[model samples]
Target chain A: MPKASAKKSAKPVEELSYEEALTELEGLVASLEDEQNPLEDSMRLFERGQALVAHCSALLESAQLKVQKLSGESLIPFEEESE
Target chain B: MQPTLFSSIHLTVSQLTLHIRKQLENDPTLQDVWVEGEISNLSRPASGHVYFTLKDKNASLRCMMWKPDAARLRVNLQDGMAIEAHGRITVYEPQGTYQLAVNLIQPKGEGALYQEFLRLKAMLESEGLFAPERKRPIHQLPNKIGIVTSQTGAALRDMLNTLRRRLPLAQVILAPSPVQGVEAPPALVKGIQLLNYQLPDVIIIARGGGSIEDLWAFNDERVVRAVAESKAPVICGVGHETDFTLCDFAADLRAPTPTAAAELATPITILDLSSDLLSARTRLTSLTLNLLAEQKAVISSFISRLKYISPERRIQSAYQHLDELSRRAFSALTHGIQIQISNVNGISKRLLSLNPEGILSRGYAIITRKDDHMVVSKVSQAFGKMKVRVSDGEFEVNRGLDTAAVIE
Candidate 1:
């Protein structure tokens, strides 16, 4: 269900995965180049594209790997299990 | 001597051998047994029966295994190989010797474990569990990754470090399980099943390198089946580069070590993604600018042609043409009048030369008869009164007297 919702652009740029953000950005560029979209529509597409680029760059800039354990219903930070 | 030892029982050689065979075969411990020893003097003749001597530091026993049992052996039998053999003790009456009848044989230590590994590998392969089509391609960019490994083991730390260095954006879910010992096989199965519920893009089952006995859990049939059945593709990294397990065969992919598994999971690094993003950003700007340039060109061309044929421009040019024509006509009229004046002056001068008044002015006199207004050139032609005209006055005269004087 989460992945299904993620496919739509309604999700915020920060929440979108790298693949998702890049995919939507590329789509916007193609539409702008190939179609005679209205000026207002083109402006909207361009702004969204810029935001996606920023989000992707930020993700790459400040990322840290996190490992977690699947508890009953939540994920907790992974710790060493006692032998 | 027989009479002296009459109290003891005397037995024939064949009878003694048969009695000994019965005693050994009838014993429950010797009826079915397992013995461990080093092989020596191993031989296989034309009869297809294998004969060998099983020995240790203290004693040695002759052993025989039929062709059927030897054919089922997974490892090659050689002299000096320490092996565990299962059969019963039997005595050959003719040779009068007791030997082990080996129905099953396996090399001891790691060799025994390897034999079982081969057996399971063969079985799984025959069932198509290790088929090429069964293998799935790992996700290029996995957002969520599931790992089944020992939380306390070095393998877990190595894998985590590798994942962090390559792709820090990925979220890893650890399913802790023991990687060795008798309890490890079921625990690994549970770990794989638990991760399956989360629906990760990939699952990595990993453990550090170890001896064959220490890594035998990965060769467990239950674990191998679990790996084969995982919904997400599994990458088995159980042992060293040279070590292999049945789970490795069943997995979608295999890596030599836990760190290698982490690397395999993240085929694309953060650097690669960053460059891709940069290019996409560049394309977005360039494409939009190009579209604007194309539209500007169209608009400018439209403006140029629109200006070319406007009515305002046409009327202004027409007014300029009218002014030019009127100026040329006025100059032409003035030139024609001047030419006419010169012609009139020349005609008037010529007319003055022919005028009689002009001759009289030169002091020439003219005489004419008044009645006919004719001039007389000979005296005989003058008969009536004549008129003489001068520049300022005129007088009348008689023509007969003049004519006679002229004739004299």
Candidate 2:
């Protein structure tokens, strides 16, 4: 049964950040609720939603690091990551 | 007089006391007392009685002024006054001490430190420093707000809280400064300068309530000038509702409290902005729809006009014109036939004028040879044996009978 399901599975080609995934999820929800899209587009959105959920779960597992610098004046080093 | 009182050994207590008070009141040496003193233990009771001790260089006297006499005094008595009092020295039997009962008082010199507050107020007013026309208008909605107050005071907390609740979008620049004491005025001026350099949209100078002396720093000329010269609009919220300062007059706007200043800085709510945006969108939609409707009407009218000049209608008009031309051609044919008939009649009359039958009636005859049935014009053609025909009948001619000269 697992080998039969693997042949039919559909996933996104590229990985997405948390914010990008959330934005795509919101757009997908809006498109599905619009009532103008056909059944084919609705199926595509359901498949994309599964990939976004997996990506969001991976981001939650990672811990963010914060660094502070003080030389009479205090400053916080910002993280470098693309949305 | 003492011997007379002594003689009356059985006198009543009231009579003896009256006689002794009269003797002391009449004494010239005890009538007036001059005291140069610093006042101590000064107590002004609610009943308008003043009880104080007046001390000189070496000694001090307990003094009491009743409500009536204290109220009548023109000068305000304070801790230190080198004064002279015009009254009799009296002894209180209970305390057993001689005290000066002040009747008329005069200051040795100007005693109570005269504040001259009105003088400074007049001087500032004369310079047109408090003119309402000179005041700048506060921004209706500031994008950035600068506050000049002590960082740890209640005024700062009130201002920050109010701003956070009312206008959270504004970027607040806190320029901390002392609000009281001698250093307060200079610190406030420096804060205003710093904010001016940064150029915030609005500045709010604020402090909590205190006594008159504590709030006097706001009246400093330097602070007032700093507020006046600031490029940004300044709002002065010094002390409570009752407290007014020179900075309040110099500022563009004055709020009763720090919280009120925050409210004044940002007047509109989110609902108002949203409503404005909605109205603009509605207007734009209506204008676009109207323009589209007008364009459609214009195109439709043009199309109708174009239909009038279409090729099919032009061809139909040409057909009607051809029918009218055919009718005119038929009329021309009838007129041509009549002209041709008249021409034929004229030719027939011309032919009749050349007729030989007509010529015979006019005494002319045509001659013809009988053999050939031809008309003869020459005699040579008719020989002796030939028969001739005249115009009316036939005749024979002989040559012998006609022996005449042959004319050439």
Candidate that would win on DockQ: 1
lDDT by residue for model 2 (B146-217), tens: 788887787877777677666554567777788888899998898888877656789999988875566777
Per-residue alpha-carbon lDDT of candidate 1 for residues B1-408, written as tens digits (9 for 90 to 100)? 446766677899988888888888899999788899999999999888999999999999999999898888756899999988889999988878899999988668655566777788888899999999999999999889999998888999899889999999999999889999998999899999999998999999999987677788998999999999999999999888988888888999999988999999999999899888888899888876776787789999999898897787989989999988999999999999989988898999999888988999899878888889999776766667889898898889875766667775
lDDT by residue (A36-68, candidate 1, tens digit) is 776656667777889999999998889888789
Q: Can you list the residue pairs that collide in candidate 1?
A: none
Q: Which stretches of candidate 2 lie over 4 Å from their true place?
A: A1-83, B1-116, B312-408
TM-score against native, each model: 0.63, 0.45
Candidate 1 chain B minimal-lDDT segment of 10 residues: B1-10
Q: Once superposed on the true structure, which residue ranges of model 1 sit more than 4 Å away at CA?
A: A1-12, A33-40, A79-83, B1-107, B329-408
Lowest summed lDDT over 10 consecutive residues: which window, candidate 2 chain B?
A: B109-118
